[model samples]
Target: MADPTDLNLPEEREHVYKQQNDDVPASSLNSTPSSSWWSSLLAASGLVSPLDFAFVLFSVVYIFFLGKFAFPPQSDDPSKDPPVFKAEGIMVKTGPAFGAVLGLALPIAYIFHGVLEGDQEGIEAAVPHVFLLASQAFMDGVAYSDRFSTPIRVFMPVFFSAKKIFTLMDWVGNEFSKVCVGGGCDAAAERRVLLGRGLAVANLVFWSLDLFC
Candidate 1:
């Protein structure tokens, strides 16, 4: 019988004494992870990426804005109860609420389908993102409404100088587009993901000083 050690190449024999711990999996070495983004981001910056934080922030903010904020009650004494909300504000909120539901619902349905097909890698990430964008859209709609803004002047005269809500509308719309596009296992998925992240960075840049409506 031939000795196995005798079959080793000269280079392999010389390096055989060293530890051979290079047991990386081919899948990891060859392709990017479906959502290694969070850890990779933390590794690179020693903090959560602004976009990831923004995604959660917008979700929490808009959820509170839409589902929880209490408007000041109307009163006979104008000074005592400044008009900060209007009847139309309630009606105006519907559009964004509907948009938010639809935005969140669409991706959730997609995730459900993926689960049925046994692709569980992305279902968790996609669900909250769509919800966040939807919330942002809702905030945009409410804040931009004159019905909501008209009354704020009495409470905080300098709250909105002019046309600022419209700016929020535009920024949220831009973000909504990114979240809308950032899904699926299509060929352009990587690009869509990057653009969706840009939405978060944009939020930090443009929507950081957001005013409550």
Candidate 2:
């Protein structure tokens, strides 16, 4: 006996339909938790590159080597020998600053820029030198500790710098190839290529001089 218009059936049906749609299915809710957690874990793992892992491994080995072999007997004074080369004033201040810029800042900037530009070759070329330089810095710190002798302190830099020269050579070659590629690139790309080449050459020169001089 109810009038269809008075019943407002369309509106009532729409409200019911919306309520059904709004109710989340238990299976969907249950499925998302495990999948999301796994996805987050994978994302985190992907962020750490192989170079980073290598750097960490190298640091551990380098430190272990220093502790096990580089260290002198407890009775023997490690500091008995005179310091190999002492830095005073400007050399002490500017030396570390220059090293930090070349080793840490420049490579990091180049790596980030390469990532943004999708330059995989450039990134690959720069990464080895970055990690090697970082490892050198780590070993240098370890060498400076009182447990190591003067000779060990001197040896660390000389050895690492020699290794770094080879890395720089590879980097320079990679950048040079990029710059000279047959098809011409855009202005921004050209500028980046030139800058990268120049930086690589500069590092090559600097490290060569550091190792030999």
Candidate 3:
């Protein structure tokens, strides 16, 4: 017979190898291939890439055209209407949490904005009427009128005024720097930034003026 010691050594080595093979199954051997397959599917579906610059450009043009075509009746004086206008109800469907926050907050923004527009130094005691009317219109637009409680709309404008004031500070700072550096700057940058500042200031002024008006 073969040497007994050599025969036993082969058997021990074979047992160790078998245990290792059992621990690592054949299905786990090609994990990379499966991952690559999923990645390929995503790429083929065009879902993995960011929106191209061309697509963004097209979308902006499309919205501009749509706005011009669809909202003509709403604009007897589009020239005076706010450039940043948005119907509050349209935003309600964006998400429940956001809708709730905005729904709660917008009436306040309107109130503060209305009071300030009237030239009040702060919220006048009588601004709630206009705030309620505006809030009702906004809720009517969104089809979510049931969500508006009377107290929420009554106090909403103060919150909105605070928010607007916060955003206005950035506009003020930027415009002030541009004006400070004045030296016959070209029409495009100067005109655009100047116009932007004017609009910002005008918006705040109008809102504030409404308090007295």
Candidate 4:
């Protein structure tokens, strides 16, 4: 016959294993749903572009830096009291709508179209400019806020607009390089090229005016 202690050893080990499992929280065991929900949300939000995400993150950090160092809690200087430029009636209404179309709607549509057409080059070309534009918009809002001074407010657009020129050049070059095979381009391809070039040129003109005028 086996010793009684040896017989009990197996049962004790089984009991200890079950106890360890029981000690874990239910939420930890069921974490799949939480992670799945986040994944679904991210997919729906069109934030899959790492470049876009990085720019957005940078904008946030820059805002925090401006608030902490550039505009600390203190009495406002008389010289920095007035804003450098203020929008008037019609501009106040149209400015944001124009920005929304240029920065958000146009880029999303272009990107989606590129994805559908399997135009990877077009998508890559557009991403940097759109990402920078989006970040610039965010920074513009922060700069316009009461927390910052006139110089800081003016600096945001000037800096971003200047930087965007280089990206816009790349975009224009990509659009222009899209050529037809066998000296015959389909209507769809022609249309895409026109639209791409038009959009790139428009941005170039707009931002140049924004920087200099």
Candidate 5:
């Protein structure tokens, strides 16, 4: 007995919608949820969420595009005024891909950092040799600058030589930054790597466990 156009119920609504398909605006279709609302709902889900997945996926694709298509083609060109620092260019363009790699590597690095502490001793012991080598070049410059009888003349010229002074200071500063006592350095790098990996793995495991609760 109800009017054919009476679209109060679901069936009637669909019928009316179909009837008005030509006349109805595209926005009035079975589009119940608004786009923004739907997107938020999808985003609320984990990495399984389509919206979040698509965003990350597209972003990664864009990075690949930049690296493969944009950056190397343009930046690596020898014709560029000042050649782009290839390492920095690659880093910026491939950041997302690199980040994902680093994320996994970070945890592993941390777990093994303390174990690798002894490896740095060999590396640290080589520092004094580096300094000694660097000093030889610098002292040679000082000796060569000894044209004047005035000792200050030789000393000042060597000290003021930006390249020579920088070389010596760089070696000394780098060695001290390693946190060595006398001839040995601390495990600072290893400790940091270990802490990062441990925390990352801990958080990831905790999050997975919490999901069941």
Candidate 6:
């Protein structure tokens, strides 16, 4: 057996140790402290943004209100009123409704103007933004549903859901153009026809809900 002492062992060991130390990262020396790791991870994940959390809380509260108040109790008495609700001002009732009508009007006018002028390009450019604003206004309309006493609540959800469908179709037509090739083919044409049909159905549903119940 060779003598271990004569193998240049100490210098090689020192060189190896130096190289290993050089290669090792400084972060490995002190791990992320347990106390702050969760917070750091949350910050890095963007799980605590103000807007995100605000919307989350708002959605929860909004749904809670929906479940609590939307469907009223049935009673045998004709004299019994459904439910009474009041808001601070007429502005509350008028604002969102007017906004919805205007939002709907702008895009519709744009599209019609384009049709009349044979400017398909212009109509294509403007309609999606109109649908988005209309959706927001529709949501506002729902948020104030109880405030409007004359029309009643039966049509509210149907209208709101129609707005939702409109918004979704707009997104599919505009944002997901890559998926459908910007309505250039048969499939895209089908989608547009489907959207028109859906809008018609939504209108029917709202009117039906208003008339019967």
Best by TM-score: 2
lDDT of 6: 0.36
Indicate the worst ten consecutive residues by lDDT in candidate 4: 3-12
Q: lDDT tens digits, residues 4-116, model 2? A: 11111111112222234546432232122222232233235444356544644665577557657865535355433443433343433345446557655687688789889
lDDT of 6 by residue, 1-213 (tens): 221111111111122232346465322321223212322333344424454334434543564465357634344321123323233345333433343343344345545654775645434534443433333323333333223222223333344444445443543354334333345557745554445444434433432432233
Tens digits of lDDT, candidate 1, 34-66: 122322332344233355446445544543354
Better of 4 and 5 by TM-score: 4
The list of candidate 6 runs beyond 4 A from truth reads 1-73, 76-85, 121-213
Per TM-score, what order, best first?
A: 2, 4, 3, 6, 1, 5
Model 1 gets an lDDT of 0.34
- Give the lDDT of residue 168 in candidate 2: 87
lDDT for residue 27 in candidate 2, whole number 0-100? 26
Residue-level lDDT for 202 in candidate 1: 43
lDDT of 4 at 128: 74
**Residue-by-residue lDDT tens digits, candidate 3, 1-213:** 121111111011122232346565322321223223322332344322243223323433543454446333243422222322122433222322232223223323433453445423122221222222222222222211122222222223332344344334544554555552365656654554455455446544544432222
Every model: Cα RMSD to truth: 24.9, 23.6, 30.5, 20.8, 29.1, 27.3
Query: TM-score for each prediction?
Result: 0.26, 0.64, 0.30, 0.63, 0.17, 0.28
Q: Over the stretch 1-213, how does candidate 4's per-residue lDDT look in tens digits?
A: 211111111011122222346575422332233223322333445643675556456656776686678765354531224333333445433544465466445865887798898877887788677666655554554454446555555566666777788878888888888785335778786787788888888877776765676
lDDT of each: 0.34, 0.57, 0.32, 0.56, 0.31, 0.36
Q: lDDT (0-100) at residue 10 of candidate 6? A: 11
* Ten residues in sequence with the least summed lDDT for candidate 2: 3-12
